[model samples]
Target: MTDYQKQSPMQAIEVNNIKKSYENKYALGQPDSKEGISFSVSQGELFGIIGPDGAGKTSLFRILTTLILPDSGTASVDGLDIIKDYKEIRNRVGYMPGKFSLYPDLSVEENLKFFASVFQTTIQENYYLIKDIYQQIEPFKDRKAGALSGGMKQKLALSCALIHKPSVLFLDEPTTGVDPVSRKEFWEMLKRLKNQGITILVSTPYMDEARLCDRIALIKEGKFIGIDTPENITAGFNKTLWSVQSNKMFKLLTDLRSHPFIDSCFAFGETHHITLKNNDLTINNLCRWLQQKGHEEIIIQEIKASIEDCYMQLAQNG
Candidate 1:
């Protein structure tokens, strides 16, 4: 087994009851925001914070990276207190914000140089750390950053973040707005980085990406609803799940919602996922009911719950 699979008790990152809030009128204006969100990342583990937009993923990243102070609670990275060891925390962590913050006018090589100089280091001194990712865009080193494609820009941003050889890397929604192929490539690069013993903490709005992390914390409205490995999370889903489809999807959702057996029904891709109060509801009965409601071409099947299903269930319960 690899070091990440060992499941040691030693924590590389510890967050204790952290809280933050914006003004009263803001979208995240809850008076008791964050309400003690806490979790830890093991050394060399690929940890993910999975949530939709406005779930406070970015706020938590900012707090952990020491870019912003929390209203209350304490956090430590590599055993260095965030408040007391702010500068040290900055040195030990590489943070790529949600938005691309690199200078658009500068070339890829220049951006790398700027970040390296800011950390008082040389790219050659730590070239090995970022070489695998940087080399893909190296041929365009002299091209302006703004001129690169979305995938290339992501690579450049990640390269700049890692030039200083940080022990922990925090990426906020790194895969957003990229093509599906680019998203796959980005996660592959993360796996390579994880193999090199770097603790990675990433946040993404995409639920499918949760499976890629060694472990994930599902967040919503500034609170963590669940935290565990992907397999465990999906296995822990106790409800009876069914995929219900009909020629009239819109009417199917409405009819299922009013069904006596259904506990919850939500759209999942092309079908509506229905959770029954009990497993006794059979497809024969469901098809007959849909037919009686003037529905045609109805289909129903028992299915396993996915990470997205678990996330939605947790969100509803919370």
Candidate 2:
């Protein structure tokens, strides 16, 4: 038995064989919306589910939040059964959906107060829990939620989610549309919240953000590709990755991918990330080959593997 199974009862969240589907009936070849998904989040741990837009992240979140039920499986939130104790689970957890779901016409303060009322709590009662986020948007408390900038709206939504002092928080792509600065600020807030002992389950499509989590599960096409700490995940990538650039970037990508010795090639920032199929692949040989192919200003160097690289590897293998 693994550590997870031995401590299953102590986890803040537990999901076992959770499966869901949107098909009305057996369509000979339709895939289940989500299949055989399972994972656990420990108390006060910042666990992240990283994947692309259609990778069943929202489905998993909806199931865990009790807003939607899985077709088959068992799950628990904060030690309470998700199905049998949904009411209690709802009270003990907070949820922030991807889209701005707050009342558009209501002012920021009004929205916060309304959510507090739903939980039979007041903003003043849990003011300390969300002080940092609330302070940033308190200056415009009277502004309509829809009128606030993307980042401010995000803060307001988070403030409202924490009004009841829930033990576990679920944020689904909370920084999807926010600016880079706000994205950084939001992560900082999460780090602080984790220190306050709130177990957080956050999902994001950004690979860079995966590094911020204590541990991350990479999901793709309705299944998990890999799960581990960011450092471990990247370090486990057993490949010779290189960052290559040339005057003809498009041609460089095309040519490298087609090369017999290259395993994979994809554009990454200003350069293309290349993986060699053979262990003997070298930068000097690659540059010389590209030069012979009419490429100019060719630059090639071995680069450290990143979470994105690991994710791609998992996707390919699975």
Candidate 3:
């Protein structure tokens, strides 16, 4: 690890009471979106913003990246005000938007050259910076960016982002729409980048990816519900979780929700995740009650809580 990675309390990004809004019909064209969103990232940390579509992830990224100004509140990147230091921030940060923004007609090498030139740097100057990621797609440097596979395109885009050797990297759902294997590869690349002492702030909708980050903030409706490491967040879910499956899933959901002893029930994979209203409720009792309710082929087992489970719990409580 580098000296930068050894710093104990360095903050690379700080956002305070950020607010933004769009026109609202009810308010007679007044702003009507985003309010009081706040979060921060530590230096050399891989922080993740986990949320679904329309959860204000893009708006937050835009504000932090200096692409769009927030209606109110202050955000600083690398200890510089985003508004006053917009130019400096732009030069010191690499932004990989959710969609591929490189020229489709440009070949892999052409795109890299374009970005490098825009930053007033040569590929050789920063070749060592992005060599690990660039080498993966260098063999296809002659191919058009649009002709590359999704995984290859992702790698190329990342290489372009790092061409300038930025201190912070903002990735807005970089893994979305990619295959699972590609997603894994992308994360491995991020880990390598973090190892190089780059502060990475990535947003993703996949709950499973939350576990890979050093810490994650769960966002909903432009607000943060929880922020912690994956293990801590899962550990804080005080409710006992049970996986229940019956012959009829729909009926099982309905019955489970209506059960007096059930606190919450959500469909999780092959089974319904059920939380008890109280610790007094036991698996045998639940099975007997389900059987009495004419639910056959019932299977209930206690299971460890996952980040998804914790997220669902928070969403439900809110």
Candidate 4:
């Protein structure tokens, strides 16, 4: 409590050994997550938690936003203790939950005003805070929140979340169901907000979006397999990858897995991405084998490792 920010302005959020369990199936952390969760977010930094559904992202967000308490461990938001200063933490941080929790009956403008009023603030006072995002949806201000398009609703939710001008913002899968264009626009808004010195922690299931963050943590089953800049994580992949396609694609996965040199193989879109046990292996060796198996129009080429590829390797190891 000795002027935390003044002492360490770079550290905006700190979480240590946080753990939560549900008595029923709706639990955040399953038995495997008993080791606890730990991570830190820097001030004004764009941090991302990348993972698929049921990865315990929502549970982690709920615990940080103070909507639900962790069974154990500790965390601080903007230097205030999550447990002892839940109220202060709530007021100082903006949280857009994965689900739409806004009022359906209220008009878009009405909902924004309601959220602003909750903190004894007004839309006018925070107009500059969310101006860029709000202007996109202002034309439909009178439309009922329930009737808005998916993209528009996300914009409004973001506006409401920013109306209070929080120092730290937590967005849980803000682009989950949004269209490609909306997702692009949303990340642009986050960059502008980051420039204004607001720390952001966003979660997304899209691996493509991982590169947009300053730093990211690749999460799976309530645990982090790797945490680093996107470039670093992919760069660490020291394996020879190949993209392969053939006329008989149905059995391609089984055939590739059967290959003695194949270290790993997974179907990706229309092609199978595989890595080799020996980097010295040649493509002709694979081509001749497929030809003997009666496969036609076989195409194989080397490719670079992507964030998804890195994740696949980690998840497979465990």
lDDT of 1 by residue, 1-318 (tens): 334346667799998888787764222214645457888899889999999999999988998999888877888998999999999999989999999899999999999999999999999999998888998999999999999998999999999889999999999999999999999999999999999999999999999999999999999887888988898899899998999899999989999999998999999889999898987678899999999999999889989999999999999998
Better of 3 and 4 by lDDT: 4
1-318: candidate 4 lDDT, tens digit per residue: 223213444688899888777775433445655567788888888999999998889899999999999887899989898999999998999999999989999999999999999989999999998999999999999999999989999999999999999999999999989999999999999999999999999999999999999888888887788888888889889889999999999888889999888999998899999999996678998999999888889999999999999999988876
Clashing pairs in 2: none
Q: How far off is residue 156 in model 4, in Å?
A: 0.3
Judging by lDDT against the true structure, name the best candidate.
1
The regions of model 4 sitting more than 4 angstroms off are 1-9, 24-34
List the candidates' TM-scores in order: 0.94, 0.94, 0.92, 0.94
Model 1 residue 120 lDDT score: 97
**Per-model C-alpha RMSD:** 2.7, 2.7, 3.9, 3.8
TM-score comparison, 1 vs 4, better candidate? 1
Candidate 3 residue lDDT tens string, 1-318 = 334335568799999888776653111011444447777789889999998998888888988999988778898999999999999999999999999999999999999999999999999999998888889899999999999998899999999999999999999999999999999989998998999999999999999999999989998777788887787889899989999999989999999999888999999888999898888888998899989988899999999999999999998886
lDDT of 4 at 204: 96
What range of 10 consecutive residues in model 3 has the weakest lDDT sum? 24-33
Clashes in each model (backbone N, CA, C under 3 Å)? 0, 0, 0, 0
